[model samples]
Target: MKKKYVLLFLIVFMLQHGFSQQMVLKKGTILDALPVQDSIPDTFSLYLPTDFTTEKKWPLLLIFDLEGKEKQALSMFVQAAEDEGYVLAAPRVLDSISLSNSIVKAGKVLSKVVGMLPIHRERIYTAGASSGARFANLVPVFIKDVKGVVSIGSSIANTELLNVKRPFHFIGITNKNDFNFTEILAAKKVLDRFRFPNQVLLHEEQTEWPNIGYLKKSLQLFTLAAMAKGFAVRDSSYIEKALREDIIKVNRLKNAQKLLLAERYLGEMMSIYGAHKNLDSLRQIQKNIRKDQRYRTMRRAENAALFKESLLKEDYQYYIEEDVITHNFNNLGWWNYQKSEIDKFISGNNIYEKEMGNRLLGYINALTEDNIDIVKSEALIDEDALALLYMLKTILEPQNFDFYLETISLSSKNEDFGTALFYLEEALKNGFKDSDKLYGLEGTALLRITPKFNALVEKYLKDARYEIIEE
Candidate 1:
């Protein structure tokens, strides 16, 4: 009997050890589809730095990708987090779901991560881009312990929800040509009034992710903030290095004759390093930059452009609504004319006007997308309204073949072969050469077999899926 009991105990111990080994997550790489809870359907993606271990708690950045691209979003932050010695997690929340549901899903993932990882509770932050950025901004408001938010390509969704006592570090990263650029500046004022710690980092691209360098700076700011707040031990070397790099960036901008950008970055530097070091010299530099005649002139020009942009946005809003409601196909020419006018501004001599033009272009495209989503979600969908919007999208973004295909499909679905063929030809004119997609497109079975379709395909792509019978 004693020998049998000893054998059973050995078997039980081996099974327990095997299970624990299987549960260990690999370090230094992305792990996808980790279950939040076995009973719950939600999952998340995680990235651990190569040196990650349970020996000490590390900062966690919860990323939200509105398009459900959790792995992609986590990938954007992986290198930054690795260099910063932070843990990265992205919940499988999507824009298709309601805001409340998205929050719940994110909350579950946050809970799971906190439970599973050795996370620094006070150093927790959130990040995302575009609509995802807006969602990240809202996370701190609804969920406690989110100490900061790295919002990219967007601003706060609503300022009224923020509480003065619960202020979190808000780092907004955007490009000059992003439509949300002006909005972020406006939000900075509100944050200032509320005494919420905040900073905005501007890059030079149009409606795209700022490079990994900016992402690294954002995490660095979070680390600095944590040190200032006593949530993490201050590293003197790290703080000095960050300040030096920022100063170098400021000088580079000044040398490039980007006076406004240099001045803005100077102010941001003061905010980040104020708690750790003396900023008297930095403050003097900012004061001198503000006093410079050329800086004043450029600042005035940018303000004027911002004012004009606001008025033009209102005009675009009114016209797009009117056009969509009336199905005003005739106004397509007017839209094209406006796009040309904006193009001239883009390529014009005035730098501020060029940026304004880019922002206007981004604004109109975003407006169209919002209206499209609204029309799509209605109880009874308006096909005509959607068709007009898709047509407008083609004008706004001619090279985006998806919009052209959507236009063709919608027209074909309505049996408006004339309109369908017209758009199909326009698509081919714009260098769309996907003969297979055209042939396989839904509601295009009859249209694709038509002579006009085959001719346009053959003319552009050199091969038509169907032969023209010459009826």
Candidate 2:
């Protein structure tokens, strides 16, 4: 009971006297560490613009990076928020905490931020990637005053909860080969049907993270939304500049003979900027694009490709779920066969099929990693499921040496040298050449000294760190 009052008193003190301390954190630089809290130390990363001051209220962007990668995420989001004169806050949540618990902790950190700074009540926003992205979208559903969401690598948390009467601007940024690519697009379609203010930004290729520019564009979307909704004053010059940049990007795609890309890009611009900026020029580009049979054919082809991608994704999800439950290591052959099919499409004559194939690979890997995180972090840890994932990782990505080493380490830690030895051999066979790093791996001391391990290492590279011995 006393602890509760102490917490409350600390909160009150921070609310009343947060700015009394010298604001030593540099303006442009990302303070990747936790704030100096006088009471409870909640881990959070913050970025204040160079011109930041407590005199005026500022828009705030609360970023949630579920993996506790505060520094990297802060760096990724800082530029966009700084450019748009918004404060960015990213909290460090642990894997041990339940989702609900983390959300509550995040709320506490946000409250501390609100207490410390003068935040524009109407312009509070949230952004994140993967599960964090989904969570960011879900925030406004439960909390008040979140005017928008910038979700990278995901769709909205729930479409059913979307109310046109109280809608928040949604900006989705994803890569073409992302596992969530189709889902993100579908989310946009659902938002479109609801007449929800939303825009989907798709980038080229597969990447775990979006390029900073996509994020910058996403931040710009919020700025535009604030102006459009009268949360902030409208800036005609800024709108025109943004529209001009969008046109140049479209032209660049078209000039590169990427007419299909240009068409889609223009369509997205129309959705995002048609109402705010003068649409006569953008509509002109769309009219010209409609005249091209090449683009028309490509659109149909893309739809067909999407249908195929959806089926394969469903297959992956279904089989993976079943496999996780049954520990169907034998069904790895089926997964391998699916990979072969994906490879065929990757090398196919049609560009759409190739992209779809890459998307499948990306989707599978992402799901695999997510499952690994789940199993590794489970309350009753499923060591077998984790071992299975590491084994599957060796098969799915033969060249990625980390999985083999990790499997070996897990086996060694469990004092199962037979399993350890097998994976050690597999790692060497897979062309992992860094012997010193292998010898230097921590928690593999027992495995490292085995004659079998030494033999494998010596055979691969004569300079084995441990000498071979005969008993």
Best by TM-score: 1
- Candidate 2 has a TM-score of 0.84
lDDT of 1 by residue, 1-471 (tens): 222112111011112212421234767778899876655689899888877767799999999898879899899998898788899999999887888998889888887778667899998899999888999999999988798999999999999899999999999999888889999999999999998999999988654688889999999999998899898899999999999899899989988889999999998888889999999999988888899999999999999999999999899999999998998989989999989989988999998899899999999999999999999999999999999899999989999989889988988988899999988888889888888788999988889888888888888889987787894
Judge candidate 2 at residue 325 and give its lDDT.
Answer: 78
Model 1, residue pairs in steric clash: none
> Which runs of model 1 end up more than 4 angstroms from their true locations?
1-22, 462-471
Candidate 2: pairs in clash: none
Worst 10 residues of 1 by lDDT: 4-13
Residue 471's lDDT in candidate 2: 75
Cα-lDDT of candidate 1:
0.88
